[model samples]
Target: MPRARVVINREFCKGCALCTYACPRGILVISRDFNSRGYYPVMVTDEEQCAGCGFCAQVCPDVAIAVYRE
Candidate 1:
């Protein structure tokens, strides 16, 4: 299986948890660090666990997540 990489646009994110909930691999988590907008962004805990399913990106209302398969 190809490896998956998730890129999050922290500046565009609004600290929503939809992506985190939609990730089947449980790799996405809300980070303690805030972005320039003062909103906590989501981070990938384990990129190796990602399945390249794009569920997180699909559910993200902010369109802040970009998933790539490698």
Candidate 2:
């Protein structure tokens, strides 16, 4: 069995939350804390739910999300 993970670039994240909506497994969420841009960034609640579908990374306009499966 392999493990899956999702990485988020906080500096580059504008917190539009498009990635959260794009995730099919409901693993992504909007952080309560706002980023420097005053917006809530996307967060991965659980790595285990990730299927490495890359929906988050693909939907991110800022290119701040990366999904990996190992």
| Highest lDDT against the true fold, candidate | 1
Cα RMSDs, all models: 1.7, 1.7
By summed lDDT, which 10 consecutive residues of candidate 1 come out lowest?
1-10
Per-candidate TM-scores read 0.93, 0.86
Summing lDDT over every window of 10 consecutive residues in candidate 2, give the lowest-scoring window. 1-10
Residue lDDT tens for model 1, 1-70: 4398899999999888898888888888999999998999999998888989999999999999998996
lDDT of 1: 0.90
lDDT of predicted model 2: 0.85
lDDT of 2 by residue, 1-70 (tens): 4388889988788888888889998888888888787777878888877889898899899999877887
Each candidate's number of clashing pairs is 0, 0
